[model samples]
Target: MAFCTSTDINCEPCLYNSISVPGKGWCLSCEEGLCQSCVDSHKRRLATKNHKIIEKCHHVASIRHLMSQTCKNHNTILDRYCPFHDDPVCSLCILEKHTNCKGILSLDNVAKNVASSSSLFSLQQNIANLVKNLSQLNKVRTRSSKQLQSDKIVKYTSVRAMRKRLDKHLDTLEEKLLQELSSKAGTCETEINNSLSEIESKTKAAYAVQSNITLLKTMATDVQLFLAIRDIDTSVTTETNWLREFANQHNTDELNLDLNTKPMEDLLRTKSLGSVRIDRIPNHVPINHLNMKEAQIPREAMCNGIDQIQLYQKIHIQYHNEKLVEILFGCIISSNGDIILADGPSKKFTVFNEGGNHIKDIHLPGTPSDLTEISQGRIAVTYGNSKKMEIAEIKDYHYKTVISVRTVASCWGISCDNGQMAVKLLTERINLYDTNGLRIQQIKVEESCPHYINDITIAHRHIYYSYPYQNSVFCLGLDGTLIWKYESDFLQHPRGITTDGYGNVYVVGRHSKNLIVISKDGQNGRELLKCNITPWSVHFDKHYNKLLVRDSEGATVYKVAFRL
Candidate 1:
């Protein structure tokens, strides 16, 4: 009779046995009794991946005994076991040797723990998640490293490109300059060679003459020599004169060389020296935009001894708006020490003393706008509304209008010379008049510039006018031709003009809030003072060597020192 296989031999084989089991499958190798579940576990388990499973026949009696025999190391009958700690290890061996180790345990104990412990599954899941996280982090690091390297390469390429362009430009400039120098050197060498060749030819001719003379002396004893000597006396005088003429020509040539060639060598040396020096061109400096400071007067300093004005001073004048008549347009100081201010809208001209005291009021019939001091204690005033000019005389606190004319256009700038007056008309033409108000000449300007001519002064036989609208100043010759023009970025609404003894031009601008000093050649300019509020007029007093600045807004005057 055939007995059924043991269910504990393998779960799958036991399932097909006469006795029933939970898992059921047919194992190909374990044909008689081995189970498919056991075969799969044998292939997957670490120590069992290479293990061979064989069929165990339930009819074989010896196989059952072999499976039950105890392991030599553990003294426990073979049962389900842990391969890591030796098969069939007893409970006592497990406690002593395996203790709390994870990989050492009885198969029955492992099975029971796997079923009961949820924490074991959780640990396996966490291990898998950690591996995935590490892979992602590695990928990110590699990508960022590559990007950084690429950016470095790009930046290096750009820098190299710029360097190459600069080198090319420098090379081109150097080559061009060197070629020019070489050409000049060649010309100088040719001239020197020609001069030396002429000197060498003269020396050779002199040696030839001496040789002929020596030969004649050696043959003097012979009869032929005696005849030759008689002929030589006659030729010797003519030869001497020819030699003197040659000497004179050589001296003249040498003098020319000293005068011309020596200067060329000196010039070349100077140029060579200049080439090594740095060449820098001056640039125009722009005006700084800033507010003006408040005007103040020093009462205690006013009583100081009457001293000559210095190069720079801080003298202030007392001002009362109500006590002083407002001259809105322009002002000028006459040779007789009288101050004339144009009261434009009021149609009157106001006169004041040097002490800021109002002296007289000249009621102008046609809006007295601008004023300039001419000769013979006379003043030239412009009428804006009537578009005419008026010549007047100032004497004993009164003004007598000598002449008036409607032929001239609206006058903005007025200047005077010995006995003549130059007026800048609104029609962009400058009209010249004699002391008797007779029109002498008229000159039309090119390019109608948008400038409100504020003040005019005569200097160096030219008429200088301030153009506040364009922030510039202009100079015209006595014949009404443009001599020079200067554009100042720093001058704002320049209304007043004055010239110092050294030819420097000074202008006062109301909105610019500063006094501007320009060089005579109009090359350099600078802001001298930033303390005047709405400076409307400026005067350079030759006798006192002082700069008088008048401010219409503050109704005050400031005394500044003038220096060359």
Candidate 2:
């Protein structure tokens, strides 16, 4: 270029001057043009360290107004100090109330601390982003609200149209029925009025010939005969024709209309239109099926010191010094595996777990012959000597009797099935009662022996009772029908009996000290176990794998484990 004037400030030589570099401002205090790097070094000097150093705006004219402006509240001229507080506040005036505040600090100092903290910048950025997101969310909410309002209007319109159609159909049906009834009533009324007018005319003519004596007598006689004939004809012809016509028109199967007969009002009032409604049959499709395989019993015995038996396996055994005591009554186990001794000479019932832990002792008013778990966590106990049965719910190892009944004979055994309790009285009769303690029925043993009923076990809609003297077990249905009687040949003195879920009957004989397993259908019988002691009060647990047996002489309970 034609040799730029070196004297011009805007000349290439001036622009290339090292001191006139970019990103710089005129330093008025230093009276020199300084770049940002040069000013930074000058600010770090010990004397200028506390001085204010702001970024230089590339356009000085744009920020020039801010440099001289004063804070309006302080009414002070712009200065290089905070006009609101202590230090050289410049021409700006600080309010008296704010002058004493201790929070005053230089703006540059505050900015420097904030800039040095990365967390402060991150927080500021996050706040700004959140504000932007909130604006966008507000627009989305407005759009969704508009759409919802439009959808509601559409649905309301459709509902209104459907309602109108339904109302129209109902109105048409109502109008048609009303018209038919009105027409029928009008026709009947017109016919009745015409018949009444004809009868009135005949009566008026008969009254006209009552003046001349002899002529009136003949007229009267002839009129009477004519009236009688007319009456008979009216009864047989007119009334009958009117009834037949009315019946045919109305489709009435029966019609009877007579003035002396009962009024139509009475008939209408007495008539009742009944309807038979058939219940809707439900679909028998099952939503889910449970494939429960029959539990298999292990061949080897699994005894936990206590005998472990599977379903129908004798779970409890009691030995009294190696002699099997006569266990003729029932037995029950608590939720904690404690056994309640029943019918033993303990005269008092004792509770013990399978681990031989004695839990409680229940003193009896009389000899408690039988025990069974009823509802509400209670057991039904029958006192043989007292001839009374009581149901008690157990809570906190205490008894709360809900019902009590005195037996006609010594209560020997008690059993519950299908919410009904059956008590075998010593009189060889089983009395049945509802769960409410109301006697429903009674079953009397009619066998030739008529032995005393010692124990009763209910299972699968049948009651099995033992006849101790007869050495037989009788099976009876819910209605007391004798289903079958099993007479034991080898077993003598069958004391107690229980049933398994598979309908297998188990009988324990004290004399033989054996458990007899009989098929449900009375097809086969086998000796399940032959212990030395009498197996009394046999019961199956929820698992049906183990049996609980109580020995009267042993005064102990045994858990016998047997396989299915």
lDDT of 2 at 422: 84
Residues 359-435 of candidate 1 have per-residue lDDT tens digits of: 78877667766777776477778876477887887777567888887754667667676677777776777778887
What TM-score would each prediction reach against the true structure? 0.41, 0.43
**Cα lDDT for residue 248, model 2?**
41
The TM-score measured for candidate 1 stands at 0.41
In model 2, state the lDDT of residue 126.
Answer: 31
Instruction: Give the candidate number with the greatest lDDT.
Output: 1
Kindly list the per-residue Cα lDDT of model 2 for residues 33-140, writing each as its tens digit: 345665677678887555443344243322222122334567553233332222324333435444543334443332222222222223233323333333333333
Reference-based TM-score, model 2: 0.43
Best by TM-score: 2
Give residue 535's lDDT in candidate 2 (0 to 100). Answer: 62
In model 2, which regions exceed 4 Å deviation? 1-329, 343-346, 448-453, 555-564
